[model samples]
Target: MERKYLYLDYLTCIGCETCETVCDFIHDGSPHIRIYVTENKQYLPINCKHCDDAPCVRVCPTHAIYRDEDGAVRIHEDKCIGCLACLQVCPYGVPFYSLKVRAITKCDMCADRREEGLEPACALMCPAEAIQYGPLVMVLELVNERRAKNIPEHRRELGEEELRKSVSSGYVLL
Candidate 1:
């Protein structure tokens, strides 16, 4: 199945909380998305990658976390036991224990809205058009394009090999 993933353009993001706000609203006041501001002032929105080899799914003793047909890692709230295993194993730290429900909650990529053919609320509310959702290949292409175009000025100081390593490692080059 062709799955949709979120792509955030740090270069284009203005540190506005619109994505976080919209996500909070969608998830009953808990924002699954988080924004990090770099020392250079770039805003990086971090969320679940929904990895194919999701460690969260593997570590869930109660089988609460499972991947859906669309490849999204979903949490079965009723099945969650609040063990926090998913929180510890997820590489991106996307999963969090919801105190309100005393269960685990994470981004489902707006699965409910997607089923209705609507984009994720965060993507729709992004004022700078920094958030995108689509097939992984297309999203990566956009990331590469924006990264290439936005290569920070400080990266010019790096050696050739260093620059290559930086780009390959997804560093914004600055």
Candidate 2:
């Protein structure tokens, strides 16, 4: 069965990269995070999206990637062949080759934390209230609200060609 998945809010993010740092701190006790922050003009922190139809699940040759009942993708490190095939096909680009493990690793959505009914480490540690973990409907509603607030008034709505674009980017495994 498919349940809700975690995601991030790029607009609320201040590009502090705290999410990345926090994940690293919790997982490795170092400054190395699975998630990365890419900031040019906007503060976009890149992380595993845990997609509805994850490519990683499909592309794993050893069947290392599998979805739980709640639709969370988990990597079976033991089953991984370390062929880097998942890295090639993942649209979100979450999987990566970990030299330490000699296998692929990606965001598990803080599975241990979730088991305790807590939010993902990065989501809980977001100081800006940027990262939200909830149902898709709720998040989309929040995004729409933010868009309404950000757009200027006294400007006549333009055609489809004039619609402003939202922050758009995906993860990249490296």
Candidate 3:
């Protein structure tokens, strides 16, 4: 299966946070996507990068965190022992101990929704279309369309390096 990707353009994001609300509603109150405000006052959308070599998958001693058939990094709730290994290793800080589920939970890119032929709530609900979900090439084209518009020069390019430069780009997760 061709891997689908989710991308965000910070420039077009109006910071309305409808994504967070929809995510919570869909996921039984545990939001997998978070919107953070940087020191520069930009709305930084943080979710799982689901890296090619996922550190969380490597560090999980219990094998609870693993990549699914669709290539999304997922936590097997039944196998999780609350070791906090995945939490420590994830660069985006996407995983968190959910008191409700009693396990480390992160985004699965709305897998259940996908099974029913729906895109992720965040990307679908984003009013400005800042968040995009589709084939990587198509998404990247959409990203490049807004390349130099209303963006700070340093962050004008947030391609595949989005995860790597997140912190240095002045996004502080609160």
Each prediction's Cα lDDT score? 0.81, 0.69, 0.79
Q: Compose the digit string of candidate 3's lDDT tens values, residues 1-174.
A: 677777777756778888888998988777888888989877677889778899999999999988766667888999999989888988888888978789998889898988898888899889989888887888888877556342454355554376356645544222
lDDT of 2 by residue, 16-122 (tens): 88888888777875332344434555556676777877787887778998886666788898999899888788766667778888778777777787788776878
- Sort the predicted structures by lDDT, highest score first: 1, 3, 2
Let me know the TM-score candidate 2 reaches against the reference structure: 0.76
Give the CA lDDT, 0 to 100, for residue 29 in model 2. Answer: 54
lDDT tens digits, residue span 94-135, model 1:
888889888988888889998998988988889988888888
Best lDDT among the predictions, by candidate number? 1
Candidate 1, which segments miss by more than 4 Å at Cα?
Answer: 36-44, 150-174
**Candidate 3 lDDT (Cα, 0 to 1):** 0.79
Give the total clashing residue pairs for model 3. 0
Instruction: For candidate 2, list the clashing residue pairs, or say none.
Output: none
TM-score winner: 3
